[model samples]
Target: MADKGPVAMIDPSQLMRPEPTFNDKPLQAYRDYTIDDTDPIKERVRRTYYEMHSKMTVDLFKEKREKWLKFNHFKATVKDALIRLNEVVDESDPDLDLPNIVHAFQTAERIRHDHPDDDWFHLTGLIHDLGKVMALYGEPQWCVVGDTFALGCKWADAIVYGPESFKNNPDTYNPKYKQVSICTKKKNFVTTTLYGMYKPHCGLDNLLISWSHDEYLYQFLKHNKSTIPEEGLVMIRYHSFYPWHSGGEYRHLTNEKDVETLKHVTEFNKYDLYTKSEKIPDIEALWPYYEKLIEKYIPGVCEW
Candidate 1:
């Protein structure tokens, strides 16, 4: 988003000492499947991830949201949508056995039959995470997932998995983080506490979440500045973070409405978590049905 060509200036070492395998952290987004045996870029993937995260800051996330979200309008036929989405491949997934396109329709197809009135909701569930395709072409895995922090200052404990990386993250122990957490009426404003950071008792639109496939694709929809059903947008953005929805990690931040929409995020996550297997959809068969669906919702030739 911040013109990586300009901003990616860092020492060669900062680029990560490339290697060939997962050392300790093996893709943790969802453990439903294993890393696929496509070529072994394991070491390169691992090192690249560290370098990206090491350099990333909260401001970077905001910049991306600003740059891309503005072009939220989608112009794609169903075939176009599928083609663009298929650009995403999951080498880290043992489940890469299926093409990435199937992953979406697999989920969307299920939702279509079960929840037609909620078809848009189903489509959101289907297409929301496709933004992870950015990693398919060599974006670092860290940039692909998310970290929890306040971009202006420091990091948060809630950035998933191993916590050691934040120690050197400049903002790790910033006094502002401590001060803000204790002082603000809008308490726990850091990315760590997602609860009240979002609008309480109102809708899911107010929540600031750890970035991920959910947030990226949601940005695509949001930047167009189209009129989104508040609940639908919320469901799109926060679907990946389970600590909030499942563990109630930041319950204090939640108002009545977030709870309600979270019920919706939860419903969507169920489809994401449960829907997948060796099974592949007949993409050719589903094309016509989806052409109508895509033509209706998206215009062709998206910006990327």
Candidate 2:
């Protein structure tokens, strides 16, 4: 199996890195950059986010937590799970319309090319979106894909499309969410006490994020007690958390552990977002190396 691996991992210093290759630069800018109604794809993306913002309330997130965290949905090997993800095309992603598997291979190969020493990182890239298989089991794309944000707290304006996109959301009517302006950091309001009461607060973990494939795969791996390190898990869990990673929101909710984990998550995001282009990876040729990595970290049938 080792004989089929790449002849030599390319060193970063020897390579030239360019922006993600794409034929339609305007339609496919970095990080879902457009929500203009003129473009059909961008319009669909906006509607998807609207649904996500409206429905992903704290109560629903808790219900999904109880349901999915059980880790008893099904069992499949790493390869099987990855292959299953091919059916899903993330509506949240404006970059590529290809199957999810292509993005997985692209991200993994990019990381492998740039950071040869970290085999675990390569595997993390491959399986990061494997939880999108939830779609096959009747889960809607709104819950399975898209950038995630905290559900219990006021929806931050930093989220994609901003808080205005959440106008019709039931959470928007709640008085707690109205207090969102206080935590928004846009005002000079010095007093923390609102009506002589402490506002809702907690660390990152205690806060319930919108349901996403990122959190699902992270929990699945943890339930199986896979050999992946905490750093790999961190990359998996928060890869879609653009609010904190990209927009620089929700810092107060993070703890010391999240601070350390942020470095790895930030590093992983480069490969995840930038590698999505028209490039098609050689799946058959690259399978052996990834097969070996899967065996090393998460062998046998993983409980989904």
Candidate 3:
């Protein structure tokens, strides 16, 4: 893990809240990825996605998994890791510009409100993005935040910015990762079209998804032996996978398990996305409740 500079603390009381339906903005108003060079924030979001699409390749995904999965980076309790998010501002997000910690509490509180009986679900929402802590160390935000896609396959048409953003990526041209198909005529003439390396209906777990905080924290929880339920874990792992869950792509690569996983991820997505701009939760007042959750499911200092 790399050294981190001082992170300024945010006072929940000082934060401004959004007003109405899905944080005052219309439901469709969120996730506006319109390309406008004149708009600084839009440009930042575009640049971040283009860079992520161009740089996150199958090989790089493998390398990142090997590196971070080692769990040798650093140690912190779940609460401490959540606090580290105070320094993270997701460049890929066009919505909410607040620190990631604010979003974490926002998501968790929303989940708790709706699913009062599911403490695990509340905790899952709180810690889903804890993997973004990699940003505080040495990882770049491009790979740490944003929607993730499978690398060893055809880029889903629904992926943010579509396939056009991946034109500069070497893996886009790599035959092994490119999706292809072939047809044969009576004379033995063959027509070929690119498909990817994975077989049809190979479970989502079998595919190599682009590296992001979602996958990192999913693996992290497993490594630390956290008792978050399978549904909660699936929610954490694939919530950022908007292409499959939200865009309705990749059915060819998913199996029965993914069918169930989709339900959980979709249920969890409401709190994650819609709650981002809601009134900031009183973090200081709320910590005790979540601390109890952390202690119950994932107590003590954990390996990063």
Candidate 4:
């Protein structure tokens, strides 16, 4: 991991932009995964993705799902889990260098600004990354953060570092894991094709996505019986799926339900990504409002 060095200071003028910008940088400037060993942030981002793409196999995905999905790790209120994020800085994120808590407030505040009546949307932004508490509890950021893609399928072209990053991944060459189709003559046998183990239009819900905080938090919310609307839960679940949402990959496997999911996730993404360089919110002052949300939607001490 590269040294984070000093936290970059935000320009006051950039704070009040009517549109999203990476501080003084353009929107295109963020999410830069360019490999450059000389650039610490770029190197950090590159290495994280390379490691993720290389090691996130179908088996490991299952193992991680089994490990985290039980929700037996520890117990805490939603607010407490979020506060733990103050200790986490996402290694996979190139844009934001501050603590995850800052980003949480930034996202929620921005959503609140735009959709004042949608309190659930505001709460969704705040807790979207709360699953990142997995980092504090011993999970690597490689698995807990970053863009997620479908496992047991051909790697999509839109993944951060491209297929080259997955050269060492065993699943990359595993015939069973690569894209395949059912054999016409033999129902039990299959032939290699472009949609892997999934049928056409299977919908995103059925796909086994690589393990990440997105899925973890989504499942965690479900396990604890959160009252957030289905759209908000979908936003939390697939917001990290940049390959599908941002890169326009995997349409062959997606269905009408995923089309609706895409709308919610894409809308949630604007606040999640572009707010990175926005003015930092006064977290201490803002907690009361968000705590009320936590109580209403997913309150009290809950299992991790």
Cα RMSD for candidates in order: 10.9, 10.5, 8.7, 6.4
Model 2 residue 113 lDDT?
A: 89
lDDT of 2 at 52: 89
> Model 4 over residues 98-189: C-alpha lDDT tens digits?
89999999899989988999999999999999988988888888888998989888888777767667889888887776643445455667
What is the Cα-based TM-score of model 2? 0.84
- lDDT of each prediction vs. the true structure? 0.52, 0.77, 0.83, 0.84
User: lDDT value for candidate 4?
Assistant: 0.84
**How high a TM-score does candidate 4 get?**
0.89
TM-scores for all candidates: the values are 0.65, 0.84, 0.89, 0.89
lDDT of 3 by residue, 1-304 (tens): 8845332322121112122334675766667777777778888988899999989998899899999999999998999889989999989898878899999998898889889999999999998988999998899999999988888778887788888789899987776664443345555654433238888888999988889999999999999999999999999999988888877788888999899998888788878887868468899999999999999999999998
Best-first order by lDDT: 4, 3, 2, 1
Q: How well is each residue in 83-149 modelled by candidate 2, as lDDT tens digits?
A: 8877888887767788999999999998998889999999999999998998898888999998888
- Model 3: per-residue Cα lDDT at residue 136: 88
Candidate 2 C-alpha error for residue 38, in Å: 3.7
Q: Relative to the unseen true structure, what is the C-alpha lDDT of residue 179 in candidate 3, on a scale of 0 to 100?
A: 48
